[model samples]
Target: MKRYISIYSLLIVLMFGMVSCEDLFDQKPLDSTPAEDILTNEKDAEALLYGMYAYFGSEASYGRSLSTMLDIMTDASLASTGFSNQLGQMYAWKINPGTSEVGSLWGNHYGAIYNATFLINNLHTIEGDQDNLNRIKGEAYVGRALLHYNLVRLFAKAYDQATAATDLGIPYRLDYEDVTPSRSSVEEVYSNIVDDLEEALQLLPVNERYDEETFTLDFANGLMARVLLDMKDYDGVIDHTSRIINNPAFSLSSGQAFTDMWLKDSGLEIIWRVGYRITDANLVAPGYNFFNMNNVSSPLLPDYIPSDSWVNLFNSSDIRLSTYVATAATGYGWTSKLVIKYPTNPDFASQVLGMNMPKPMRLAEMYLMRAEAYAYTNNDEQAVADLDALLENRIENHQGVNISGDALKDLIADERKRELMFEGFYWFDLKRMGKGFTRVPQENTSTANDLSISADDYRWQWPIPTSEINGNTIIKQNDGY
Candidate 1:
């Protein structure tokens, strides 16, 4: 069950650090600590910020697990592959983490929530430049909101305009409470997500040196666009992405530079990302922040090959195909798999998984979001132009596309799927349009392999985590979990 804190106990435990307080208070403490107590120095404060990145990187969260889980679960007009079982579970609307990885997603996203709460609950106390304090707080706010968004997608139903007002969602928590907490409604969750973005926008500077990690205001805005898009708030989508589209830092990379740039940690497009740490134990896959696991950070081994479908998506002369891949012959064999983005550095010894993890938001996507908003708003010219701008830069034989009506919309959606494959946007796209998860387009059945559904089942919204139900009796669960 969801647990909460008591207002009083949450404070004493703040500066004092974690101690045995079970006997001291009957209920958990809530938000009693001020921000000053959080940091003794800048480094201490910075260290605390890393917790947000870690939370996002956890297997249950966006890290490798989520990216893989989301894609395999979808039937993309392609036949089923080895990852089809759990994928079936997702496509079918039957995912109970009480027994599977869904639990990990619940655990990790909340871990992010807990960390963000701790930091935001205490960020103000650090007696530094007010500007610095505000930046940190702003980031914490964005991080907290982003984590909540991740949780809601996995735990609550899709934001059905008809039922969202009444649908239950994960509990909304921003303070350091220790009391058992319950879930909120889906509408409440969306409201909270938007609220956080607004606050984060206000507090976050237009730009900053967030070390090799962290999200900026533009990044937060991009995320806001995504959340709003899911809620069917098309105007909100345009309003948010426009902030970055209005800015110059966000642009599509072209030619070899695009391929080369993806592997770098400090590129202009990344609004936020989990830095790759390359030690065997910490080693993780390399690829886009997209959902497809086919994109590895390392090159393919002697016989290791890509999914035949992923390869055939583009033609022999198409740009993305050759640019994004490498044979066993490339780069000292450090990366022999997909190696879609960052690869292991040749200089590092005792190699492990690359720590350069995924980012929830980036610049390349900003263009697509803007294009989509324009497409739906009936601005076909702007829509095609924006998408063309991206496509021209990505593929070699790419000619400008002229599309109209539903076919155009579908093409745009397909373009996004091809461009952002592993980044985790496909399923969300289908659901907002009330589509299905099946590739065969058989029928809209809920179970995996039924082949009836369009891969659009709202079941992707994860079942409520056990901790919430078992711990907080006051809470309620979503239906069809």
Candidate 2:
């Protein structure tokens, strides 16, 4: 009973219109207003919806943990010697049901879900512009789907056609009611995600020039493409990616433009990015885990540095080599290659360090997903075309490659690693592809030890939080927890 009480604390806080002292929800506490009267007009609904987005971008979600966890958990990066140990437990693969990070992540995601659900359930009661109302409703649906999609991927086994129906997934919360529900199957959760995305497409405006912060038609399609890829629906992946690829508003960034994208957080390739402002309370930069700039002379006090093997994968000719990786002496003796992907945005550099916005969906990923889907469907010509198209934008003087069969699939996987490393995708790719890897110790770092993770390892599916297990009578823990 005590365990159950805490599990619903976040939902109750949201439902009661109370805001935390830390401003975690980024909204004024409706201390004077009744919870039932909070969403009495369009203005109230809009505020609620914006608050949901704020929480989604909070450190507990994409601003930090969700964006960097899997990257550190796998071989993409390693904790440096004498590091701050911010996510050291995850870096060492020492996770359990009682881990604080796991619980915080779980609570944060559900908190955002509750906000979205509340707006979705009550928005219809208020009268407003039909278009405005629809837009808010649509964005809420997309937000819910996006949160659940990430939750399912992290908590359940990789979507296996034969086993997905039985695999436990995080509960797909759709209402504001206080009820403890059993975990849904991976298949059911995914089905709900798809339905939400499809519903978003119908209600969201069809403008190509939508704000990077808002959910748009392109964002919904791009997300659907990603979801379909994970489910191994090749035709569906291709179909959805093609819609975004054909849009002229989004194009792959290259050369100086590409470098600026990471440093300044501006790019045409970005379909949806969480916007972070300097004025926001308790702002946590997504890239701070990789590169925390202390001062001009040393500048880097990174919690995690790029793994040697991953750094070796990039060629000097590739623009990503320069943009993503930089060598700097820590003033502690040794010079190491650091992940500078999330360096300070120029506008906020004076006030903050390592403050770039998180770009979750990009045009480059669309090309990668389409290429992989094409390869699987035996469309070798189209697959190579898509691969070379992306490579040409990324690699300098890139000559086109003629490859097919397993070779094409391998190339696509490698390219994904190169393009998306540190932004988070390493472990999930391994899980879905049924592959394992060994982490070799980095130089001069006793903390960096050799660890091999097998595809069949139970740790691939994160343990359900112990609090949830104790609170919800029907919730089952993942295997080996």
Each candidate: what lDDT?
0.60, 0.78
Candidate 1 off by > 4 Å:
1-43, 76-94, 176-178, 209-212, 279-283, 286-311, 323-356, 439-458
| Model 2 C-alpha lDDT per residue in residues 32-87, reported as the tens digit of each score | 46556888888778667766776656666777777776777887777777577677
Model 2 lDDT on a 0 to 1 scale: 0.78
Q: How does residue 97 of candidate 1 score in lDDT?
A: 39
Q: Candidate 2: list runs displaced more than 4 Å.
A: 1-36, 293-299
Global CA lDDT of candidate 1, please? 0.60
Instruction: Point out the worst 10-residue segment of candidate 2 by lDDT.
Output: 1-10
Where does the lowest 10-residue lDDT sum fall in candidate 1? 19-28
- Candidate with maximal TM-score: 2
Tens digits of lDDT, candidate 1, 256-275: 66655554544666676655
Local error of candidate 1 at residue 441 (angstroms): 14
Residue 224 shift from truth in candidate 1, angstroms: 1.5
